[model samples]
Target chain A: MSEKVLMKGNEALAEAAIRCGCTHFFGYPITPQTELSEYMAKQMPKRGGLYLQAESEIAAINMVLGAASAGVRVMTSSSSPGISLKCEGISYLIGSDLPCVIVNMQRGGPGLGGIQPAQSDYFQATRALGHGDGHAIVLAPATVQEVVNTTTLAFDLADIYRTPVMILGDGALGQMMEPIDFAEVPRRQCPAKDWACTGTGMKRPHNIVNSLYIQPEDLERLVEERFERYAKIEAEEALWEEQNTEDTELVLVAYGITARIAKSAMNMAREKGLKVGLVRPITLWPFPKKPLDKLSATAKRFLCVELSMGQMVEDVRLVVNGRAPVDFFGRTGGMLMTPAELLAQIEERMGK
Target chain B: MSADLSFLHSPRITLITGHYGTGKTNVAVNLALALRLSLSPIALADLDIVNPYFRSADARQALESAGVEVILPAYANTNVDVPSLPARVASVFDRPDLHAVLDVGGDDAGATALGQYASRLEECGYRMLAVINARRPEIARPEDAVAMLRAIEQASHLKVTGLINNTHLCEETTPQTVESSFQYADQCARLSGVPLVLTTAEERIAAQLQRPDLLPIRLYTKNYLERF
Candidate 1:
């Protein structure tokens, strides 16, 4: 048995990145995520890693791109608006097929919404992180322990697929404290970065890391090849957790912090003799459609809960495909919905 | 199985400070609520500018309803993350009749907020207690804990007169966990030349410990689902 220590979600994620051999961290401070950057600043140098606070979020993400291009494990983190500033760099990372980890401790909204927890960036993370037909592997962990596990996995997935990976968290998840043991975190073997633009040393052909292709045919060919990789990830990398789904009438679908709330509500509904269950998607980008697709065959309906105004509900609706009616309940601007409120929503949704 | 809370009586002003996420805010809130029974005109000032969430101000409704005046940072409970202190924090010091419980932030960064009021606090005669959780990595060892205490002292320009052992793995805490932390807290107290005044445990775990020094408390700064 290993010693378990209490740590905030952001601190745990930062420490997990260090343990998993993330050698460089570039970030700008934001609410709910400043602790991550602050931790990196204090500990990275001690652990023989580099931590840089760039002039802006745009500069920080570009620094991540520069570091990732050199074949090092690199990461950058931000909140919602700060993440929006990194979109151009994210697109460049995808265009060049660079591997790096990006953590978004999401706060509310379309613009400078609030410094409270929110899942409003669901569409931004899943559909339009950057302007392209590219996708990043987005993992939304519901607990601090899972935050550590997924952060390590995010780096591995990035290196393995040579595509960016996103750890989607909310303010509540980032700020809360939980007990976790680092010794229990799994370590993945990453392949060598042969494509990295490390100095050739006159040994072989010089490698180049660039997103710009002058010829449209060359760019299209590259994008098509990237789509194949995305297809494989969608098939093999989607992860989800199902609880009490057997013969259940109503299945609640949620990710990130809302999933934790939904789980409690699910148990409450069951105590009241309602056939309620929960499907928590740990992977938001791949969307975890298989389990939902299978459940739609038996479940009467789906309820999507979030800290946003109906973002992930769209994904649930798409997965259910009218096999069952999809419903949504959300609280915006950093307000958290209580389990009792969710229970009431469940009772009303079931027409009880 | 009730805790002996007499140790908290004479501080006049009690400022809780410790490493980040070591249950400082929880302890401050619980202490304020507990003291309100015997003490009059209780006030809790949220001096945590380092953290943007889960501050003592978040429990304003509960604290205010219990008749504990809650003084928060200027931008607390709002969308802004500015590290502004409330002008009313001076009132906690000026009014000699008020029993003030200041919830300082985590680490030296968080303690900087307390420095500006060092002279006023000294005039009012305060006892700052550093909460220690052996499970937290930065201050797990006695030497490290003392070093953090010294750093906080330097940052806040005030001496920590006492230590509180608050070791736990959140809800996973067991009596054994609290028992095992005794030596660490004792050593920290000895090394820093400060008295080990109290050890806090959850109400259930505290009953099992059956220790006189134990202060039984219900964790208030938990997630909504944890309480539900």
Candidate 2:
């Protein structure tokens, strides 16, 4: 009952969202990520999903908050600026303890950035999605199949953790189409809706979903409780794929689109007698520090490859604890580095 | 009922059908878009209940913006495990401004749903075009092609309006095969009253065909906002 179908990463996400019970979507037009929104626009209507072409990123994020508070597996997506606007809502959802999916099909930006895919949002998504003392369950899928798999998992994690889950993808992943199995998707066992604020009626007391805790004591209590949930989520959702990391002298740490290319380059270096392997972090937030730290102890050197000016490399350095000499490779503003370029980097580092 | 001389009827509703490698859906999508210059409000519904990969509706945004109403089963409507046809499509029957193009699954038991919609299609006035790709397995001969069309018309309750020559080998297709397809289409036209309304060639390959009188074709993949 399953077969291979070639699809763009964005297309696979839409299909996966449908398969995984993502019936509500709100997004604005952003290049490199336009396909995803376009997919939703055409397919959502037919599928009976709520697809709103939000007036602005602010409106879009609020729409997501509205839907998420209703407990309808809601999601809103944008690139850099769009994601920045979404941060406040993300913090709100975290404070209010509402579950939802937030996809950052990352594009280059500090402000109104270029449409080219970039990983600059790593810290934005990983450290602080919005203004607050909070964390998000962020997943970075490297393949088209993983895009489907990770997004589906994001929905589950958001529900289970009652927090927002960020799917960190760049333009390269969004645009490239590859063969995938849209069928084997497991049915999502919806969590108890007792957490949702869908009007309690007279069933006990009137339910309320708000980030506004008027009392400082109540706000501190809510933040502390949410942090407890975040701790549990961090323990549970740290995901990374280790490709030949055990015996390798030099290990490359990467994620999302860049990670796939890194793996290919590492394998090429492996063939060329350079002992380089790839460690891909599937969840950027839980950041896979323990495993990376362990690898750091054994590995003679570490390399971090990224689309930005080596942002994740900083995380790698922090996790490495100076156990190994860390190196960095990068291309910014949507320029993709080929396997050849990465292989050269690995070879150069090995020569060092 | 009256002389509905709209673009949809000018190039009748023909279906491109076959197995996975048969190039039917590809031909169907290309053909529908190629005929777009004349503003054909083609209804390309992927009844590919067999294989959900590369569905016609994936390109719905392009067609819809071009004023072509695309039909696909409501995915978000219900939690139903299997995809069922939308009830509103029955209105395509009464509306002359519409054209109904169905891309059904392969010849196996997957195509049985066609019988249910066939009669309604007849009353609504649709011209079903059976597609043949010589390179497709089990559907090479004219007889085999006719049988596939017959099976679809029986299942879908639509008449074979004509034949479409969609002889392509994906991105590797050449102008020669498309030209030979044109000849095969003439043979099909001789037997069936439905005219061989068109043949498709990649814009590059269409340039290679170099025939001034060739029917319309879909050679380019248009982005969504470019629908007009």
Top-DockQ structure, candidate number: 1
lDDT to native, each model: 0.90, 0.71
Name the top TM-score candidate.
Answer: 1
How would you encode candidate 1's per-residue C-alpha lDDT over A30-63 as one tens digit per residue?
9979899998998999999999999999999999
Query: What clash count goes with each model?
Result: 0, 11
Q: Please, what is the TM-score per model?
A: 0.97, 0.64
Off by over 4 Å in 1: B1-4, B226-228
Could you give candidate 1's per-residue lDDT for residues B1-228 as a string of tens digits?
656666666758999998988899989998899899988899999999888878887678889999999998888767778888989999987888899899998999999998899999888889999999999887888998999999999999999998989999998899988899998988998999999988898898888886777788886664655321
Model 1 C-alpha lDDT versus the unseen true structure = 0.90
Candidate 2 lDDT over A1-352, as tens digits, reads 2635556677778778877788999999775676678778867888889899988888888888888888898887777778888778788887777888888888766777666678988988888888878888889988777888888888998888888888989876786555566666654565687867678776867567898877999889888987787788678768888878768899898888787778778778888778787788888888888778788778989989888887888889998988889999898865678888888888888883
- DockQ list for all candidates: 0.61, 0.03
Q: Judge the docking of candidate 1 as incorrect, acceptable, medium or high.
A: medium
Model 2 chain A lowest lDDT segment of ten = A1-10
